[model samples]
Target chain A: MRKLYTKKLSKKDQLKDLEARKETVQFLLNYSKALRVVKCRGFTFDAILN
Target chain B: MNNVEITDAVLVREYMQGNETALSKLINRHHHRIYSFIFSKVFDRDVAEDIFQDTFIKVINTLKRGKYNEEGKFLPWVMRIAHNLVIDHFRRNKRMPKFDNSGDFNIFSVLSDSDLNVETQIIKDQIENDVKELIKELPEDQLEVLTMRIYKDMSFKEISERTGVSINTALGRMRYALINLRKIIEKHKLVLTN
Candidate 1:
């Protein structure tokens, strides 16, 4: 777990860091989305339908 | 001729000549790294997948239209396309609330509000934790770049200046870190939640 040193952070800064961290997590979760998209492209729906 | 030994330019030419296999060969050769690169950006499986397909479709259309000019560097070119698509996704969905980081935001509340069941939520959280743990396994150099960029939210130029390395070196470390992370994910067969 990454720790944010909040002792020195102003409340506003703390909230900003929290928002940034949340955005990072959201971005990380999207990682596999690209992999699945690429993999799926390899399989042609035309071949299956035929 | 073995498709594997042919150059990217040759493959592009063959593909443009209605040789579908040539395109498949090109895709097979570069898909892993390209996909890994895009996955590192988007993180969501379905959205990344859509962009990946769109990138290639654009690649095909560009080739057919004789717009592809990068003779031997097809992978980077394809990645550029995927990166643009990710940017477009965010732009199009700018109004959608991606994450709530307010004081009232709770993991339980977020999970419960979603359509996923409790068990699925647990699994998803577990996978996210596992992914974070895997990131720690990276080399110090790679980890430093990834941490500063992703966790600290630093730009590559800032990271380079702070770490006493060239901007290219910082960018290269990030690329290697993503590639290594992708390898780890594949080796562990870790399934990420959509």
Candidate 2:
């Protein structure tokens, strides 16, 4: 399976991979904040839906 | 320095001086990354949070004893403390972490609050799960470095300092981590084509 990505990935693909990782990092950081909020005050599903 | 940095540095110094609020602020600022790093390694949120608090307690104690020098980057220094706590935990547990098949062990699973549309949340969860699977296939050293770099946000230099390896070797580990992750993704045929 490594053969498949190795064949398709160019330098451009590497750049895109890096960009994707950056976005994931930002998502994870924001996700951390969300978890903290939940810990302090349980899920707010009703609040969100209201 | 800015408020955050000054606040962090001040808190570190104050905690060193035995101010409780300052110590709390330091934990509030850095607990997320530290917790996430430990959670990813041990794959248990409850245990992760326990270790997270323990790490801070150790830091506070160390500071009071004048054991920690006020390094310019308080964040990195604090992370080093958390990293050591995690290693100690694994040593004490005497068991390797098993893959959590139910997706319960995926740290990101907790993100699937009912607030978001169910479909969107599920997709996000699936991606995170696939990423974890890909990580499992990476070589141990590459996996450790990738976890440290990505989850902990530690710079190559910091990782080098902590691991006692050269900076270039740290950078090379990151490069290999990415390359190996891409390989693993392809091997599993997970559709990350880009």
Candidate 3:
């Protein structure tokens, strides 16, 4: 529940933008996860089996 | 089970069994939320990334030793670990942290007022920075309560316990923080939301 103070936008406008913001957040979330796997593989491969 | 259906408890079991892939999958599922949460506190991508990695490493080590027994959402559990690491890192470094690596969250630190694409990202960063500034202006009591409630995600009841204030007082402080933030936003003529 990201409470935003969207006083400037009308209800319809707010809904439209909220969807976009949610998508952006979702994208960033995916990017972050990918980065972790890349980092983990670097250390895991080195720490084990070699 | 596919990674989506995999719960944190299940992953912990797999990780305890020394299943490397399971550990990787867990990281993939949670890395962003944890990273973003850390980035918010430290305000640096490189530092956040280091803390993020260290947190998972700690989790792995702890689980291997049969220690993690919390029964709730794994994401928040790992997030708390990352939060502690950031605090520890800050204490050890004894300086205002800065981003190190070139990553998505680190972009917030590198901009030279050019090459802006997503308006929402820019706006979100601006709002956060503004809110931080306003918080600094608040009295110590209000600031502390607000930080615990908003950033730490602690409840009013918990804040009252931690700060030795009544629950009503805790809620009052949060209300004041929001009012203060609203004033700051208005002063700068910044739109609060989309």
Candidate 4:
């Protein structure tokens, strides 16, 4: 009975890990997409004097 | 072996032997990380670029004078020099706190005074895009934490809450993210150009 209970718990842990990884991946994809549209304004040293 | 395959110590030796391209290669290999580190600290694109140029000019001059001591670890040595230059800039501007006891001297604290020229804006955007490309290589867990910490400038607690993880897990992911990113940079021999 104890062995079976441990196996069930391990499976639950694996599912939780998978869920976390999926969430993380979704966040990164959205963040990278957002980065594509972000604008920045600044000058390089070469451009400043020229 | 070609210049790219040569080790940093060997390149330094070749540079010392009066081969200008060897010096150029050495600079090209490490300039991106050094530049990004300075930019992170200063947050002023023009100032960062100037300091980046100055850091290398100083490096070349020091190498020519035979003053560079660290033989094998050129990048870290040069990074230290660049960091000191950033601190020196703040000191010269009188913006650095006298004691810095509170330890609140962050780049975000320094206000930038850059005019929004179109060309400059485009250049800055290109650099950011390049950085994003590098960051994209990180694992999902690491990528999420790193993006939040860096681009979003979010605290670990905020990141944990948003990601639904404990603070420790959030911090761990960030650490792994940095390690993974460094590995990717080395594996791909990425050269970030501005």
Candidate 5:
């Protein structure tokens, strides 16, 4: 939330942007979840080889 | 085994034993709570998402490196990791609020801006050219104040009167100008000095 943007937005506009913001946040959450799978696989294998 | 009865300690043991799904299960079970915790602190999705990822990365590295010893307290352990990362994020930003190294999150904190000895660095002709180009990217109001203060070598008092804005407004725009310039530099990965 950019303070400048929030300061300028009306209540209705804020509601409109909420859904779009949630969509991006959802994407980031899923991306982070997917990245963990890769990181765990590589590191776990390294643990075994060590 | 019912998921309800499976404890964090058990999942940790299973993951170490090469049960890959065990790691997935642990993450899924705690993802929402952890992400919310980070989001509450940062207020911005981009920043919160970054800290959340870092928290999990540290969690994975510690577990895989066999450094995790907090047997049954996985949630608390993960929360602590998130907390520390959040603190580190604030510390870095606070130390260099005006011109942060967004990529490394460690520009001014490593060495304060004064230590950079900008007086000598100003002798580099390229730096002057690069700075001029960067300031052009600033918003109109911010650019006005920054240009006045730096290139024109005008005081904030003079800037406020010339711009017909208050001294505080002039000062704020100047600060924002520097911060935005840093963001642009970080985004482009541009190096102004050798």
Candidate 6:
């Protein structure tokens, strides 16, 4: 991989990134869970259907 | 073509016909390419793992229900599911996060609410405990950052200094930790809250 150097983040940008992460965690969590409910339990026809 | 490798199409057919191990063969055969594809898009291992597992979960469901009919195109079909999952990941991220960590940034507000009913409150307590336990499962750096941020109530700057990492790296660890926790919670169908 190339060493693609970048500039340092400003204090404002760092704080902004922190705040953004704090906010988005919940939504991402919910979406990931919704993708599968059958895997937790065994893979059965009734479970997949329902 | 006897020396030729068994094709994915053949594996899918066998799995559908009650050969359970065929699926594992298929997974092993394509795991690297599919995983790399997912990781390239998300650029995070935890998120990529979730997406990869979810992709195959969807695949198994389709195959079990006898709905997989994309003959001779198994890899592409799987790739499509992975692609859609990547889209789903970003779609959720793009939404305006509903948290209100506003000007004061009160951590308590994010952690608990006074208005929950009895059942939900109890469940939330259990989930919180489970999340705390899950902390031990995180990578060392992520565990360190999460421990300090949530329990010790340290700001990112403080965590960055204590951990000897940039603020961005600190936040990244927290994100990966939460992502893994949420994946486990969902896999078990644990209702963390109302």
**What C-alpha lDDT do the candidate models reach, one value each?**
0.70, 0.64, 0.67, 0.68, 0.72, 0.72
Cα lDDT for residue B52, candidate 1: 71
Per-residue lDDT of candidate 2, residues B1-194 (tens digit):
35545457777777555555675566556666666666666655466666766665556445654667776688887678778888888887767644444522566544455576877778878888779777988888788888889889998888888888998998898899999888877777778422
| Candidate 2 TM-score restricted to chain A | 0.32
Which parts of model 3 have CA positions greater than 4 angstroms off?
A1-49, B1-4, B95-194
User: Tens-digit lDDT track for model 1 on B1-194?
Assistant: 55558888888888666666777667766766666666667655456567777777677666655567866888778878888998998887796747655344478755666477888889988987887899988999999999999989999999999999999999999999999999988888877765
The ten-residue window of minimal lDDT in model 4 chain B covers B96-105
Q: Estimate, for each residue in B34-74, the C-alpha lDDT of model 5 and write its tens digit.
A: 77777767655577778877776677666655678866899
Predictions in order: chain A TM-score: 0.28, 0.32, 0.32, 0.33, 0.32, 0.30
Q: Taking the tens digit of each residue's C-alpha lDDT, what string does model 3 give over B1-194? A: 35458777787677666665677667666666676677667665456656766776667656655567858667778877887888798887777554455333555576656655698689888878777876787778889998998899999999999999899999998898878867767777867564
lDDT at position B132, candidate 5:
83
Give stretches of model 1 more than 4 Å off. Answer: A1-50, B1-4, B98-194
The residue pairs found clashing in candidate 5 are none
Candidate 5 Cα outliers beyond 4 Å, as residue runs:
A1-50, B1-4, B98-194
Listed per model in order, the count of residue pairs whose N, CA or C atoms clash below 3 Å is 14, 0, 0, 0, 0, 0
lDDT of 5 by residue, A1-50 (tens): 54332245543443332211345445433533344323454554332221
Higher-scoring candidate on DockQ, 2 or 3: 3
Cα shift from native, residue B160, model 5 (Å):
42
| Deviation in Å, model 2, residue B68 alpha carbon | 1.4
TM-score (2 decimals) of chain A in model 4 = 0.33
Better of 2 and 4 by lDDT: 4
Q: What residue pairs are clashing in model 6?
A: none
